[model samples]
Target chain A: MNESDLPSFLLDGEEIPFTPGQTVIQAALTAGHYIPHLCYHPEFVPHGSCKVCTVKANGRPAAACTLPAQAGLAVESDTDELNDLRRTLVQMLFAEGNHFCPSCEKSGNCMLQALGYDLGVMTAGFRHFFPDRPVDASHPDILLDFNRCIFCKLCVRASEEVDGKGVFSLTGRGIMRHLIVSAESGRLADTDIALTDKALEVCPVGVILRKHVGFAVPIGRRRYDERPISAQALDDAPRMMEPKHG
Target chain B: MAEGRIRVATASLAGCFGCHMSLLDIDERLFELLEKIEFDRTPLTDIKHCGPCDIGIIEGGCCNAENVEVLREFRRNCKILVALGACAVTGGLPAQRNHLDLGACLSEVYLTEPGLVNGQIPNDPELPLPLDQVHPLHEVVKVDYFVPGCPPSADAIWKILADLVAGRTPRLGHGQIQYD
Candidate 1:
């Protein structure tokens, strides 16, 4: 149907004309609602992981990242069920690995840290499993501790897609599964897999880092304090903090 | 043994001196630490490879046959063996080529060229044979305390060591990046 022949209706009791091929969250984003999320960068294809941005659409919790927008659909993007689901997901992430935020350099500025706070993940409901892990700090300018990784796969996808390096890959299985730096050495410096700014920028957490920059910007003026990494739907709006996180 | 001095044996299997360098980064506090730590066999102090100790600190990853032998000896002797640095921690940078065929790496980087090393690989009687893959110390021996940092920051190493001296289990990431 042509633009003139499209259906015009009320979305959340507000008058709006629907656009084609956008998700309910995307339309909501366009309509100025900042739904919280991680693992859903605008440039990449939808992954729908890190269920932090779940929202109730038509009375059921739906992942805002992958759900498609329909004509005049009522999406309860801010319902209690979705909040509960997000809280549960965050709690699970807390239980999975060694995420000790207080000692972490990214304490005040981490996105995962912020989401855990937003979801009220005070304690991990499940038993904590402190897996033995080796951190790769061989690279002159990057450090990696897989123990701190949440398996968001953003670095793996970014390195493969945006940077064309495909340097990072996830390996192993079950609780033993981990992100391997090259073959399985877990050393980033040894591999010919070069680093790019793209992979450095998209890492939701601090698994990857630019050396010599920790605590460089001080506490009060840190990125998380300035913006609080919740749902960023600013529509190509430039986030002005330091972006090297891969 | 006056009271509660933990006997820690420090040894290197197949890595550079960097891991030891990280340990020394603990600095002047070593004097205060000497009151608590009892070192029986260490590369810096003791020359003998064999030792009777409580906690064994093994630097370097196992690469050559000599390294493997040294690691096995330490694993056999010590009550708790701690893998230090990237080398011992996860095979470090040396294992980067485990993904590649040894023949291909040998020919590409060393041989198949007009340099001194040609298509034929080196055949030395003294040199130990290289393994098809590099493996972390944990893959071979059970590790009690896992300190995952390249060469862990001085504070990290200190915290773990201090906790050990205090008879408490050393833990990392108080909940920083942790999530399920």
Candidate 2:
């Protein structure tokens, strides 16, 4: 089929041209439209664990990051219903973990925090779970604050797929599922994980942080500090890049 | 109506009064604000108890019995109560102690810290007892509105107040609303 005959989908009333295998998120991003997402990094395979990118496709709720964009598909994102659902999902993430944003080093730069702001999640709507998670500062250069993990698994994917070092993995299921270091000693230092690894930069929250560099960028000048996540998403989207063919 | 101005009361509970500072950050706008509203039971007025007021803006979480009492009193006296910052809205920095044992926390602060000469956890009857967990103001009393920030920006506070003074519900949008 010719490139002109490629499938195009309507995302919130805008025509987004997509390759046969491109997901709604990929097409939307490529088309300069921003869909709020956490676990759908472009470099890694879409892991729809966080459900922040849920959109209504043909009147059915679907994960935009994982859903294939088909011709004539009507994907509704940024609606009141989808935003409310996204807010609830953000609230659930907040309640599930001890996401103390004010004290966190990753406060302004965190995608989760920025997304929460974007979705108008003003409060933790659910009761605080206040889970007793451990902070693994065992690594000499990295501080693994488990209390803020959203379980997006970007670090896991980046470590295993990109870095060629299977350093991180998620253990357990459902509410109990958590990120675990793949080392006999169960510490990041024991693993081949380095500060320069893609895994360190892949975390969307304050979970995997480099030690001694807390609050390096200051408050008002950090990423997402100047603009909302929606704007940031569009600005950060790859420019003029052709859609990847399967 | 006989009342010419909106009666406003504000208080700080377990907060650092940064929200009040942010309110002050309204700057020269306060002169304009005074034309529309009047301070009642606020730290600005040094009033101990709030009289019946048009709005009550509380700026911290309920970390002690006094905070709860003040929050409840604010609910009773004010027509509308607003949670004015992250603390009042979500327990903020004070709530960090929620993860640690309260006794251990107090002990660490008092007895176990380095360079402490004579350290004893104060148990004065006059002192308000800290709750086992720090709670957002809404957990204790109904909050009519919320202005969320570490301390909400001066623009945000001004917007909320200006909206309230104009008899409209305040809504924060992109630039106005910030979580950090």
Candidate 3:
């Protein structure tokens, strides 16, 4: 097929050119358009778990991370209805977890919090669930504060696919579902996980943090502090290919 | 009900009073605010109870029975209620205790801690009994507006107050809305 004959899709009225098999989010990101996402990382297979990137493709709601960008498809993402849905998802994440952002080391750099700000999620809509989850400080170099996990699976994919070390996996189902270590002892320290592992850098929330580096970057000088998530998503999208740790 | 001025009442229940401090951060602009809004029931005025008012600003989560009662009273007395910080909006730091057993929490604080010379969980009827879990303001009553921050910035509070005083619905924009 000719270059001009290549398939394209309309995302919020902008023409997004897509090669065959490219998801809506992939095409949008390449085009400098950001569809808010948590689970979908470019380096790994698209995981549609976190549906914060849900958009209306042909007036039907679909997760942009997994949805294929079809020719002439009208995708509505920035609409009030879609934004409200995203806000509800973000709110659910907040309510389900003990996300004490003010105390979290990843406060300013957290993608979940940044997305919440991007979507204008002012309140945790539902009543706080306050699940009793344990923090794993067993690892000498890493601190796994399970209270802040949003179940995005970015770390799971990064560990499995990129780091070549299956250190993490999601266990259980529904509200009881949570991240579990792959080691027999069920501890991150038991696994061959290192400080330079891609898993450590892929966590969108404050769940997987490096020890001895809490609040190293001050509040005002943090990544998402200076600019909103929307701008950073586009500008920093390509930088995902660069090795984060090492 | 004052004819010319907007009546504002403020309270801090299970919070650190940081939001009130942030409100005070308006500094010289507070004098400008005083010209438009009058204090009704607030810590600033040392008022005991919230009177009938145009706006009520709550700065803490409902962690105790007294907090709930004060929140309910505010809802009954005020025309519009605003959750003025992370605590009021999302239960904040006080809500961190929601995951642990209430009894265990009390024991940890009173019985187990080494610092206490005479460690005992108080059973006095005079003390306000804490709820099983900390609850955000909306969990107890309808919150018309939410100013989200650890303790929303002085400018954010000022904007909300100024907008309300000017007969505008409170809306945070750009730098005004921050989670931390």
- Which is the leading candidate under lDDT? 3
Give the TM-score of each candidate: 0.52, 0.94, 0.95
Better of 2 and 3 by DockQ: 3
Model 3 gets an lDDT of 0.88
Candidate 1: tens digits of C-alpha lDDT, residues A80-124: 667777777776775566665534566556677667655544344
TM-score of chain A of each: 0.82, 0.95, 0.93
Better of 1 and 3 by DockQ: 3
Q: Please write out the lDDT profile of model 2 over residues B74-142, one tens digit for every residue.
A: 999999999999888888888888888999999999999999989999999999999989988877877
Best by DockQ: 3
Range of the 10 consecutive residues with the lowest summed lDDT in candidate 1 chain A? A237-246
User: What's the candidate order when arranged by decreasing TM-score?
Assistant: 3, 2, 1
- The CA lDDT of each predicted structure is 0.66, 0.87, 0.88
DockQ of each: 0.02, 0.62, 0.78
lDDT of 2 by residue, A36-83 (tens): 998888777788878889999999999999998899999999899888
Candidate 1 per-residue lDDT over residues B1-180, each given as its tens digit? 456777888887766767678788899878777898888678767757757677888877777777788778888888877776656655655665555676787777667666653356767898788876666676666766555444555666677778777878775433222221
For model 3 the TM-score comes to 0.95
